[model samples]
Target chain A: MKPFGRVVICGVGLIGGSFALALKARGLVREVVGIGRTTASLERARELGVIDRFATDWATALDGAELVLLAMPVGQMLGVMQAMAPHLGPDTLVTDAGSTKRDVIEAIYSNLKSHLEQVVPAHPIAGAEKSGPDAARADLYAGRKVVITPLSENRPEAVARVREAWAATGASLHDMSPQEHDRVFAAVSHLPHLLAFALVHEIAGRANAEQLFGFAAGGFRDFTRIASSHPEMWRDISVANRHALLAELDTYITELAWIRALLSQGDGDSLLKLFSEARDAREAWLAGRFDA
Target chain B: MKPFGRVVICGVGLIGGSFALALKARGLVREVVGIGRTTASLERARELGVIDRFATDWATALDGAELVLLAMPVGQMLGVMQAMAPHLGPDTLVTDAGSTKRDVIEAIYSNLKSHLEQVVPAHPIAGAEKSGPDAARADLYAGRKVVITPLSENRPEAVARVREAWAATGASLHDMSPQEHDRVFAAVSHLPHLLAFALVHEIAGRANAEQLFGFAAGGFRDFTRIASSHPEMWRDISVANRHALLAELDTYITELAWIRALLSQGDGDSLLKLFSEARDAREAWLAGRFDA
Candidate 1:
C-alpha cells in the first residue's frame, strides 16, 4: 500500500494525537502536519512523535494533504471545516472524529461542497477520561469499533479510504446512515454519559454526598468514572445529539419509573427478578457467552 | 497481637475468601475454617490458599473457632447465624462483612441474642465484580475503609477485637451508626448499582440495543461493569436496604426531573456550568484530594 503523503490532523488533542500515532505506526501516512488551537499542544504533539511538524494555521496544514482529520470538538468542527475549505486539495480526503454525525455532515456539506465528495463523516469509538496529546496512545483504537456514516451521494472511494485508514489502526469499521448512527450512539454512548453526568450532579448536590462518597465502593467508582470526563465535549454531544438523547432518556425514565413503583409498593420479588435478569445478561456478556 | 486460634469464615465467596486471605497473609489467624453452602467452592477456597480448611457445614467450621466471620449474603446471614448458633463458642468474636449493617445487626440480635454482646456488625467497603475464591486477593483491603457499627449495649472488647482484625488486614476502620451507614451507602453504592442495572435494562429492551452495543465505547463498558456483578447479592442488597435505597432514589429522581426541565427549557449554559464544576470536583478527587 502506498503511504498517504502530507496528512493534516486538526485539533491535535487525545483523539487526533492517537490517530496520528496509529497512522505513523502503521506507515499509512508520511509527513503528518498537526494543527491545534494552542501552540503548547502542537509542540507537545511534535515532542510526543504524533506529528512530524506543527502548524497554527489550518490552511497551511491542509495544503496538499491527501488526508485531513477534523478532530476538533463537535461544536467547533463547522468553523474548522469552513476555515480549511479554501486550502483543501481537489482529491483531499477529509473526515471527522465527532461523536454526532448529522450536524457535522450537514456542516461539511454546507461549508465545503466541492470537497464534500471526498469527505466521510466518521467516529472512532475510542477515548479515555483523560484528554490532550499527553494522554494520547498509539493503541487507543486497537480492538475498538469505528463507525462511518455515509450519505447516499457520498463518493464510495472516499468512504473506502476512511475505512482503510481506521482498519490500519486495528479497528473494525462499520457503515451506517448518518441518522441511524446518531440514534444508535445516542442510546449507547451519549445517553449513558448524560445519565452519568446527571447522577454525579444529583449526588454532588446532596447535603451528605461528600460524606457518602467516603463509603463509596468499587461499583460507584466504575459507574461514575466517565462522569469525570471533559464537560464541554459532553455538553456539546448532549445538545448536538439532543433528539436521540432525549428519546433514550425517555426510555430510561420509564424504566426508572417501573423500579420506583416496585419499590414504593414493596414489590421485592419483581424488583429482585428485574435486577437478576439484567445482572445475568451482563454477566453472560462479560463471561463471553454473549457478545458485548 | 496474638493470632486468633481459629477463624471461621462463613460463605467463602469474594468477600469471605478475601477476608480469609488477608487473615492468612498477616498471620493474624492460626487457621482459617471456611464454611460454604457449596462443597466445590470450599475445595476451591482451600486450593486457592484462601482458607486452611473448609467444609460445607457451618457447625463444623464454627465448632472451635475463636472468631466467627459472617460473610454471607445479607438475606442469608440471619439463617446462617441461627444455624451456627448451636456451635458458637461463648467467647467467639462474631463480626460480619454484610453491607447493610442494620439488617445484619438485627439478625444477630434476633437469632443469637444470648451471645449478641460478642457480635460486632461491620461492613468492609472494598470488593470486586470477580467473585468466588478465584478473585480473592490478600491486599484487597489495603487502603480501603471498613465501617463498624457498634451499639451502646455491644461489648467494648468485641468491638476492639473486630477493629484490630480488620486493621491487621490493612484496612482503615471508621465508626458509624447502622442507620447512618445504610443511608450513606444507599447514595454511594446501592443507588449507583440500581441506576446501572436500570440503564442497561432500558437499552437492552430497545429494538436497536444489540446493534447499538456493537458501537458501545469504553464509557458504556466501564459504566456498566458493575451490571455484571452477582444478581443474587445485588437483589438482596436492594431488598434489604429498601428504605435507604428508596430515599436515595427519590433524590436522584428529583434531580433528574430538574435536569429534564433544564433541557426542555433549553438552559444549556446552566447545565454546562453545573457539569463543569462536577467534572472539576471529580477530577480533583481522582487526583487524591478526597483521600481520608
Candidate 2:
C-alpha cells in the first residue's frame, strides 16, 4: 500500500492519538496533523510523537490533507463535519471514530451534502477506561474490529481507502448498514454500559454505600468497571442511539423482572435453568473466540 | 496456634480443595481428609495431594477430626449437617464456607441442635472463574476477607479456633451478625452476579445473538464474565437470600427505569449527571481499595 501524503486527526484523545501513532508506526502516512480544542492537549500529543504537527482549527488542518479522521465525540461530530466541509480537499477521504454510526452518517450527509462521496463512517470498537493522549498506544486497535457503514453516496475507491487505512492498524474491518450497526452495538455495548452506570449509581446513592463497597469482591469490580467510563461520551451515545438502546434496556429489565419473580415464587428450578443456559452460552462464546 | 490433629473437608471442590491446600501449605493440620459424593473426585483430590485420605462418607471422615470445614453448596448444607451430626466429636470445631450466612446458620441450628456450640458459619470472599480440585491453590485466600457469623450457642473457643484456622490462610477475619452479612453480600455480590446472568441471558435469547456476541468487546467480556459462574451455586445463593436479593433487584430495576425515562425524554444533561456521579463513585471506591 502507498503511504498517504498527509493525514489529519480531529480530537487528540485516546482513539485519535492511537490512530496517529499506529499510522506513523506503520509508515502508512508521510505527515500526521492533530486538531484539538485545547493547545495543551495538542502540544502534549505532539510531545509524545503521536502527531507531527498540531492545529486548533480543522479548516487549516484539513486544507491539503489526503485523509481526515474525525475522532471527536458523537455530539461534536456534526459541528466538526460542517466546519471542515468547505475546506476538505476534493479527493480527501473522511471517516469518524464515533461509537454511534447512524447520527454521524446522517450528520455527514446533511452537513457535507456535496462531499458525501468522500465520507465513510467508521467506528473502531476499541477503548479503555482511560482517555486522552497519554492513554493512547500504537497497538490499541490491533486485532480489534472496526465496522464501516458505507452510504450509497460513498465512492467505492473512497471506502476502500478508509478500509485500507484501518487495515494498516491491524483491525479487522466489517461492512454493515448503519441501522444494523446501531442495533448490534446497542445490544452488546451500549446497553451494558448503561446498566453498569445505573448499577453503580444506585449503590452509591444508598445510605450504606461505604459498607456495601467495602465488602464488594472482584466480581463486583469487573462487572461495574465500565461505570467509570467518560460520562459525556456515553451520554452522547445513549442519546444518539436512543431508539435501539431503549429497546435493549427494556428487554434487559424484563429479563431481570422474570428472574426476580422466579426468586419471589421460590422457583429455584427455573432460575437454575435460566442461569445454566446463560453460563453455557457465555462459555461457548468465550471458547469460540479463543478458537478463532 | 497449634496445628489441628485432623481436618475433614466435606466437599472436594474449589473452596474445599483450596482450603485443604492452604491448610497443608501453612502446616495447620496434621491430617487432611477429603469427603465427596463421587469417588473419582475424591481420588483426584488425593492424587493432587490436597488430602491425605479420601472418603465418600462423612461419618468415617469426621472420626477423630478436630476441625470440620463444610465447603459445599448452600442447598446441600442442611443434609450434610444432619448426616454428620452424630459423627461430630465434642471438641471438634465446625465451620462452613457457604456464601449465605442466615440460611446456613438456621440450617445448623435445626439439624445439629445438640452440636450448636461447635458450628461457626464463615464465608471467604475469593474465587476464580474455574472450579474443582484442579483449580485449588495455596494462596486462594491470601489477603481475602472472611466473615465469621458466630451464633449465641457457639463457644468462644470454637469461634477462636475457626478464626485462627482462617487466619493461617492469610485471610482477614471480621465478625458480623448473620442478618447483616446476608444483606451486605446481597447488595455487593449476589445482586451483581444475578444482573450479569440476566444480561447474558437476554442477549443470548435475541435473534441476532451471534452478531451481537461477534461485535462484543472487552467491556462486554468483563461485565458478563461472572455469568460463566456455576449455575447451581448462584441459584442456591439467590434462593437462600431471596428476600434481600429480591429487594436489591427491585432497587436496581427502578434505577434502570429512571435512566430509561431520561433517555426517552432526551434529557442528556440529567443522564450526564447520573453517569458522572457513578464514574466518580466507582473511581473513588477503587482508589480506596488500593490505598487500604
Candidate 3:
C-alpha cells in the first residue's frame, strides 16, 4: 500500500494527535500537518513530534493533502468545514472523529456540498477523562470500536480509505446509519452523561451541598464520575444530539415517576421485582459483554 | 477493654459477616454466634470462620449474649426484633447496622421498648456488591465511616459501647439524628441507587435491549453498576427510606425538567454554564472528600 503523502489534522488534540502518532508509528503517512484553534497546541504537537509541522490556515494545511481528519469539538465543525470549502482539493478525502454523527454529517453537507463524496464521518469509541495533545496515546484506539457512518454520496474509495486509515490504528470497524448511530448513542452514551450531570448539578446547588457530598461514597463517585468531564465538549454533544437525547430524557423521567409511585405506595415487593430485573439485566449484560 | 463475650450477629451476609470478622480480628469478641433466615447461610458462616458457631433460633442465639448486632436487611428488622425481645438479656447492649436508621429505630422502639436504653442505632458506610459469608473480610470497615443515630432513649453507656465497638473495627464515627441521617443518605446514596436501577430496568425492557447494551460503554457501566446490587437489600433500603428518597427523586426530576427546557431552546450557553458548574462541584467534592 502506498503511504498517505500528506495528511492534515485540524484539532491536534487527543483523537487527532493519537491518529497522527498511530499513522507515523505504522510508517503509513509521509507527513502530518497540525492545524487547530490555538497556536500553543499546534506548537505543542510539533514539539512533541505528533505532527511533521503546523498550519495556521486550511489552504496551507490542505494544499495537496491526501487526507484530512477534522477532530475538533462538534461545535467547531461547521466553521472548519466552511473555511476549508474554498481550499479543498477536488479529490481530497475528509473524515471526522465527532462524537455525534448526524449533526456532524449535517454540518458537512451544508458546508462542503460539492465535496460530499469525499467526506466520511466516524466515531472511535475510545477516550480518557483527560484530553489534549499530551494525553494522546498510540494504542488509544487499539482493540477499540470505530463506527463509520457513511453518507449516500460518499465515494466507495473514500470510505475504504477512511476505514483503512482507522483499521491501521488497530481498531475494529463497525458500520451504522447516521440516524441509527445517533439514536443508539442517545439512549446509551448521551443519556447517561445527561443524567449524571443533572444529579451532580442538583446536589451541588443545594444549600447543604457540603454536608450532602460528605456522605457520598463509592456509588456516588462512580455514578457521577462522568460529571467531571470537559464541560464544553459535553455541552456540544448534549446540544447537537438534543433531539434524540430529549426523547431519552423524557423516557427516563417517565420511568422515575413509575418508581416514585411504587415507592409512594410502599410497594416493596413490586420494587423488589423491578430492581431484580434490573440486576439480572445488568448481570446478563456483563456476562454477555461482547455477544450482547 | 472487656471483650464482647457471646456476641450474636443476625443475618450473616457481607455487612454482618464482615462485622463479625472485624471484631474477631481485633480480639474484641470472645464468641461470635451467627443467626439468619437461612440455615445454609448460617452453616456457611460457621464453616468460613465468620462465626464461632451457628444458631437457628433467636432464643438460643441470644442466651447470655453480651451484645447483639442486628445486621439484617432493614425490612426483616421488625421480625427479628420481635423474636429477640423475649430472649434479650437486660444488659445485652443492642445495636443495628441498618442502612436506614429511622425505620430500624421504630422497629426497636416497638418490639424492644424496655431495651431502648440498650439499643443504639448505627450505620456502617462500607459495603460490597457481593454478599454472603464468603465475602466477609476482616478489614472491611477499616478506615470507613460509621454514623450512629443515637435515640433519645439510649443510655450514654450503651451509646458509648456501640461507638466503641464500631471504632474498634478501624472505622471513624460520627453522630446524627435519625431524621437527618435518613435524609442525607437518601439524597446521596439511596437516590443514586434508585436512578441506576431505573435506567437498567428501562433499557432492559426495550425491544432493542441487546443492541442498546451492545453499544453501551464505560459511562453506562459505571452509572448502572449499583443496579447490580442485591435486589432484596436495595428494596428494603428504598422502602425504609421511601419518604426521603421520594423527595430527592422529585427534586432530581425537577432538575431534569429544567435541563430539558434548556435543551429544547437550544441554549448551549446555558447548558455549558450548567455543565461547568457541575464539573466544578464534582471536582471540588473530590478535593474536599474527607473534609466535606
Candidate 4:
C-alpha cells in the first residue's frame, strides 16, 4: 500500500494529537500537519513531537494531503469537514475519530459523498481522564479496539486503507452498523458517563459535599474519576446521541426506582437477590467468565 | 508494648482472614484464632496460614483473646458481639472492621459495653473485590486508611494499642465520631458503591444489557469494578447503615431529578453550567487537590 503522502489531523487536541504522534512514530505518513482552532495546541503538538509539522491554517494543512482525519469534538466535526471539503485533494481519504458514528456519518454522506467516496467513519476506543495535546501519548492506541462503520457509498479501497491505518497503530478492529454502534454504546459508554457526570453535579451541589469528599475513599475516587472528563466533549456526545442516551437514562431510572422501592418497603429478600445476581454477573465478567 | 496474648477474628472471610494474616505476620499477637459460622472458610483460613488456629465456637474464640476484632457482616456484628460478651477477656480491646460505624457503634454501646469498656469501633478502608480466605492478603491494609471511632468508655491505652496494631500493617489511622464517620462515608464510600451496584443492576435488567456490555470500554469496566464485590457484604452494609445510606440515596435521586427536569425543559444553559462545574471539581480532585 502506498504510504499516506501528507496526512492532516484537524483539531489536534488529545485524540488528534495522539493520532498525530502514532502516525509519525509508525512512519505511516511522511508528514503529519495538525490543524486546530488554537495556535497553542498546534505549537505544543509540534514541541511535543506529536506532529512532523503544524499549521493553524486549515487550507494550508489540507493542501496536498492524501488523508484527512477529523479529530475535533463531535459537535464541530461537521463544520470542520465542511470547511476542509473545498481543500480536499482529488483522492483524499476522509475519516473521523468521533465516539458516535451515525450522525457524523450522515453529515459526511449527505455533504461530501458527491466529491469523495473515501469517507470511512471510525472510533478508536482509547483515552484517559486527561485531555489536550500535552496529555497525548504515542502508545495510547496500543492494544486498544477501533470500530469502523462503512456505508454502501464508501469505497472498498478506502475502508481497507483506514483499516491499515488503525492496524499500524496496533489497534484491533471491529465492524458494525452505525445504528448498532450507537445503541450498544448508549448502554455501556454513553450512559455510564452521563450517570457519572450527573452524580458529580449532584454531590457537588450539596452544601457539605466538599467536607464529604475529604473523607472520600478509594472506591468513590475510582468510580468518579471519569466525571472529571472534559465537559464540552461529554456535552456534545450527550446531545449528539440524545435519543439513545435518553432511552438508556429512562431504563436506568426504572431500575434505580425498583431498588429504591424494594428498600423503602423493607423487602430484604428481593434486594438481596437482586444484589446477588448483579454481583455474580460482575464477578463473572471480572473473572473472564463473561467476555465484557 | 507487650504483644496481644491472643487475637480473635470473627467471620474469617476476606477482611477477617486478612486481619488474621496481618497480625500473625507482624507478630502482633501470639495466637490468631478465627471464628466463623462457615466451617469451610475457618478451615481454609487455617490452611492458608491466615490464622494459627480455628474455632467454630464463638465463645471459645473469645475466651482468652485480649483483642477481639469483629470482621463479620455489618448486619451480624451486633448479634455476634452480644453472644461473645460473656467470654470476652478482661480489659480486652474490642473493635470492628465493619464499613459503617454509627449503627455498629450504637449496637456495641447498647449491648456489649456492660462487659467491655474498650470498644474501639473501626473500619479498615481496604479489601479487594473478591472474598473468602483464598482472597486474603497479608498486606491488604498496607497504605490504606483505618478510621476508628472511640466510645466514651474506651480506654486511651486500648485505643493506642489498636492504632499500633494497624500501624504495624502500614495503615494510616484517623479518628472521628461515629456520627461523622457515618455521614462522611455515606457520601464517599456507601453512595459510590450503591451507585455502581444500582447501575449494574439496571443494565443487567435491561433486555439487551448483556450484549451491550460486550462493547463496554475500559471506562465502564473501571467504574463498575466494585459492583463485582460481595453482594451479601454490601446488602448487610446497606441494611445495617440504612439511615445514612438512605439519606445519601435521597440526595442522589434529587440530583438526578434536577437534571431530568432540566433536560425535559430543554434548559441547555443550566445543564451546561452544572455539567461544567462538576467536571472542573472532579478534575481538580483527580489531579490530587483533594484528600483522596
Q: Rank the candidates by lDDT, best first.
A: 3, 2, 1, 4
Model no. 2, DockQ: 0.70
Superposed model 1: Cα runs more than 4 Å off: A287-292, B55-59
On a 0 to 1 TM-score scale, where does candidate 2 land against the true structure?
0.98
Q: Is candidate 3 or candidate 4 better by TM-score?
A: 3
Which residues of candidate 3, in runs, are more than 4 Å off?
A1-3, A25-27, A289-292
Q: What is the C-alpha lDDT of each candidate?
A: 0.82, 0.89, 0.90, 0.79
Per-residue C-alpha lDDT of model 2 across residues B1-292, encoded as one tens digit per residue = 7998899998888899999899899888899998877788889899999999987676788888899999888999989888888878798889999999999988998998999898888999986677788988889999889999999988999988899999888889988899999999999899999999998888888877788889989999999999988898899999999999998898888899999999999999999999999999999899985221
Give each candidate's fraction of reference contacts reproduced.
Answer: 0.60, 0.77, 0.78, 0.55
TM-score of each: 0.95, 0.98, 0.96, 0.93
**Of the candidates numbered 2 and 4, which has the greater DockQ value?**
2
Clashing pairs in 2: none
Q: Whose DockQ is greatest here?
A: 3
The residue-by-residue lDDT of candidate 2 on A1-292, one tens digit each, is 9998789999888999999889889888999999877889899999999989987776779877999999988999888877887788779889899999999988987899999889899999996888999998999999999999998988999999999999999899998999999998999899999989998999999888888888888999999999999999999999999999999898888888888889999999999999999998899888875221
Chain B TM-score, model 1, reads 0.97
**What is the C-alpha lDDT profile of model 3 across A152-224, one tens digit per residue?**
9989999999999999999888899989999999998888988998999999889898888988888898899
TM-score of chain B of each: 0.97, 0.97, 0.97, 0.92
Range of the 10 consecutive residues with the lowest summed lDDT in candidate 1 chain B: B283-292
- Per residue, candidate 3 scores C-alpha lDDT tens digits across B34-142 of 8889999999899999999978887898888888889988999999999889988888988889999989988988999988899999999985678888988989999
Ranking by DockQ: 3, 2, 1, 4
User: Candidate 3: lDDT over CA atoms?
Assistant: 0.90
Error of 2 at B250 (Å): 0.4
Q: Candidate 2: misplaced stretches above 4 Å? A: A289-292, B289-292
Per-residue lDDT for A91 in model 3? Answer: 76
**For model 1, what is the alpha-carbon lDDT of residue A30?**
72
